[model samples]
Target chain A: MSSTTQIPFVDYLILDDPPYLQAQECKSCGARYFDRRNACANCFANNFQPVAVQSEGVVTSFSIIQMGPNPYVSAIVDCGGTNVKCTIMKVEPTPDHVTLGMRVKLMTYSMGEDNEGTEAVAFGFEPI
Target chain B: MGTDAIWIIGSNMTKFGKHPDKDVVDLAAEASRDALQDADISLSEVGVLGVGNLMNASAGIGQQLQKQIGQTGIPVFNVSNACATGATALRVAIMAVKAGETDVGMAVGVEKLAGAGLLGQRGPKPEAETWQPNGRFGALSSTEGRIGTSIMPGVFAQVGMEYGHKYGGASFELFAKISEKNHAHSTLNPLAAYQKRFTLEEIMNDVMIAYPNTRPMCSGNCDGAAAMIVVSDEKMKSMPSEVQSRAVKVSASVLTSDPYEDGCQILPDVNTLTKNAASQAYEQAGVGPEDLDLVELHDCFATAELVHYDNLMLCEEGGAVDFFQSGAPWRDGTKPVNVSGGLQSKGHPIAATGIANIHEIVMHLRGEAGDRQIEGARVGLAHVIGLGSACGIHILEKVA
Candidate 1:
């Protein structure tokens, strides 16, 4: 029931230079959807174009995780399109201070470093 | 309206978790036989069969169980509802007797986690490639960032952190205390997963799983089964006095599903469902929480039990820590809880947890809960909550 905005493949690749966050958008309903799909999640409109969105939103809800496979800041972001919930990277002092409606900007980082030291970059949010 | 009253005649359960020698069918049949033998009844006397199994992993559980139990003609219905499968089955059996559908019905909840081995034993998986904005696939699976982790501990840890932040204190001490208490109680329960006692300091300093949550605070995965037999008063009258003496009446059995609201915490939803269920149960049993002698709540994590205290109205919100510190909810407490160690110590085999809770309450009411029995328990309550926020609450009273 909530609206979502998608980040186009071209925009994501140009921004962080990765294909993981590529998304598609519908011009009719203005709903953005993540993951590569030919059809839009809303309005079922096939008419769409590539666009770069500022990877920033406010933290709506967050949890200070303790016992997980890999500890990270998990939260929901109201990115003016669809309030997306995503894990943030390189944030410190726990997710408690990342209060509701607090500004957060996305960053490219890896959860854990690889052997080659050229970390696998993924999209994460941080306090603005 | 039914003329006869439904009474629980007997209950039995096997130790939970990873028994290679026993498969799911074996566990169900074994527990069924044990329950029947405990009641001194034969398989032919079972007019109907109800089975609760969440994940039997490609095995045709219902058909297989009927074959294993040697019950050929009677109706055997298989029920599944994430973690509340066992409780759901029990409800069906109770209703059948209450509605005059059958004179005798058996409810059995079984799981064979051991057969799955390690890789197959992982927690619930994601639906597909649809990635959630939270970097996770769905509600069940972990984020791509964190694989091989469980959602139970992770979700509860989030609750713990929120509670800590709002209350201006850390939850480590409370979590440790809860673990310590359940562990102490488990020492007296022979069937519990972990019988070793743990100190608060030990629980606090143990290996961390998520923040503020230690390994001991989380429940371990295991395999096992539990079963109970219910019969109408007319059928029960023909049984031996010893069997009749153990009869426990079903006061209430209620189930509820998830609410439509998003961002709603899991524990609060459980509280709402519990209150609704308990109110109905108390009215039917002619008693209230104040009159309860003992209870067995779903304690998959230490924090879960603590949250239950407030949710079950044992204490006020933010009052569980104080109530727990006062040594209440213990075997000697006014209203003892988790005397069988709960899921924290007893092991969580998903579907089996509900019937398992009922099994403990029946034992307590029968004055057969060796060592951990609440002295002269007249009324007891059991609450089992599952994934997707499904919950079942059963209230039992000893038949005079």
Candidate 2:
């Protein structure tokens, strides 16, 4: 009962140096995905390489969600060439704060703590 | 002579919106009964059943129909693909007829969500919360959901912003105009959930569900059902003159799922895989977007319809504003779209929404739309995308 356990939502998250999101990039077509799969979408290639995404990105799309789940600022950020969908952190989800094409850097922190004190750390894009 | 062509001889839909007294079985059975009547065939004459419903228990629907109608021991196939449930069922029916597996099959879709209290039902129970890591909402999309939590509104709203950023000309108000067009179109449709027209200002000013989307611009939960009776040419030839006279040909039916990608994933595109679907549909129907007289697209959100205009090839990229305001997709215009009010005004009953779109197109093709009829309508297309998941597109032509 003394074993320590920390979990990220999905297997894509890594707690390594200069921590960044890892995605599956197709070896043939260079298509990348956030989830694991059997084959590449573009070329149907079975071989893929795990690539760490760039930490810096540009906000291609942003939304100020007012209802349903929670009022959090979210955006689709284009990191280098691939798109990274993440929530915006440490800023209000208002028109003044969330701007398109805004430069952002990847950041990770504790999303929430379960009843057993296990931390679920989530990654997000913060305005630079 | 090939097993490719199919025809929809009859279609029926129950009145949409909240039905406090009626359960789904009763509603689906009624639609099926009316469909058989419309096809001028007795229940005992039916060959098979393809029923569509979603996120609700419908295991008894087949037996319920058998009891309501004469006990016809026909095979029943149920299909579900999110919001595309109806069209998916319709495709199954068409394939059945085309393959000569059944001469006459019925595609029926129903949903009774109003009294179901979906929010309480869909949410996690107290016991399940213990398993959820950090007790975060699980229904939202993967990486995005882990950061923020939401259902459809937040994802679609993000699509709205992404659309705006891409086009640079698209605005939040542009989405309101799309809603107003569909709402105005619904006033002439008695079966639509909301027949009242609203100004664009009123639509934008309504209760904000998410950024850039108000209640009026969002699809609503409702209880509704739609059914279509499809038959092969041989079976159709044996139909009565009255039924045959109004029959609509199912020229093309294409279903596609999202391509695995890393893009903003509200859906692959507002078009779903519609580019591939529409092209294949056009080739099957031997018609293109230019040949379409009317379109009954899935307007789950006004933004979807706007982006779909480009995706469907009805307009150029970023040309939705002018294409909409140009008075084109109106009832009397060159290419009328969502003349049946769409999900915005018609209310989205999930599974029924797709078939309801088919029902409207068939009615238009047959000159039976009444007040919302597109004069001299020749061909129509209906498209629906189920989440960022799957899509179904059907093209219909009136048999003269």
Candidate 3:
């Protein structure tokens, strides 16, 4: 048996212990963003602090994408005040199964493994 | 600004469809030549040249155009601004003349996108369905599949759905109906990519692209080119009576980008910037939406057109659905829209779309449009929006 080491797919995603997303919150406007930035897009302040994003969120908008390799649900989730774009995993990709204002929580799953037995983990939101 | 107005003396475009025999520069040169002939102007008289191209930006299309059309030693500016590249190119020429850099300037926009599939369709995996990671952790996987979508159809699909959720309307059939109208309009436009009309049933039952948007509802990806020649008021006075008689006045030319907005960065906001541009254009032209006789908007998707009706202020606030349901955008309706079949059938050649839209408007305003002409069309508006968040609007008036 081979032991696999897990790694976060993006810099904003944390893999240690409980996986959660981290955002660069503006010190001036209190705006949160997942990507790294030199200044806040809202107030244009150069200072930003990395803050942990809430795992639970409500679906604000979604689309059932069929153009992909397989049918999947692409959605924007409103976590408290911040909005996150993610796929709704572990649910049927249907209008009845997925809907607006649906409650979901962030979860990590293995995408695939490499020659070194290192697993790349990606995050998605699942029904809570 | 005193009668120091700018006028589009000549405008022309190649039939928007497959041009297997011609290349990009060939199409650009043809359109430029035709436009110059229409203007009764010679290449030696053109003071500046602005070329718009997206897929072939690094090629220095402006310099290449000069080689084919005549080398007048004029300032050449090659611009690329997503779908708005063409409009941006024309803007460059207008600005040159406005700044007293040149009196007569030429702007050309060309693109060869025939057989180009969906805008953001992803390619094959790294290793034939098998992953062989080599990085410190592993091969970096994209956020597209795991997170929300990045494709144009999906983005617009969500945007349309959001509009429905907010205001309560905009059904799937409604969006399909919008596509049907555009397809029907294409039947009269010989230059359109697909001239055959599709019924509402056919459109609704067509292959699904995202959700509400079917295959027929999307813009046609085809090859085409359009060119325009602009002259200042001072130069227009010196032109012949016949040459000045057909010139169309450029009342307003406005371009805008995305402003900082919350929860909209991931999915580009197509409405805000468009609304901003439309208002600015109307203000600059000293007119309102009621004054528009016809409009050629960026209908990259049927769903997009609905939101833009409101964004363009063609209708009342939160009344896009009502505007369509009222049949005001039809060819014979009160406010004719996309009389040239829009991008849906006119074909979206990217860089060419901007100038092509203006070309359609100019043709109608001059009462030169053949079968697809809007009768008594005097004031027209041309709009094109690019995904990287750029919106360009030009309001044209027939010089009396």
TM-score of chain B of each: 0.88, 0.91, 0.96
What does DockQ give for each predicted structure?
0.14, 0.40, 0.49
Residue B218 of model 2 has an lDDT of 82
Q: Count residue pairs with overlapping backbones in model 3.
A: 0
| Winner by DockQ | 3
- Tell me the tens digit of each residue's lDDT in model 2 across A1-128: 43255666556777676677888888888888766577766678889899998899888876676664556776778889888777888788777777888999998886555667666666787889
Task: Rank candidates by lDDT, best first.
Answer: 3, 2, 1
Backbone clash pairs for candidate 3 read none
State candidate 3's TM-score. 0.95
The C-alpha lDDT values of all candidates are: 0.70, 0.78, 0.88
TM per candidate comes to 0.78, 0.90, 0.95
lDDT at B313 for candidate 1? 73
By lDDT, the better pick of 1 and 3 is 3
- lDDT by residue (B116-173, candidate 2, tens digit) is 4322113443543232533222221244344543456666666667767877766778
Off by over 4 Å in 1: A1-70, A75-85, A93-123, B1-4, B115-143, B146-150, B165-170, B265-269
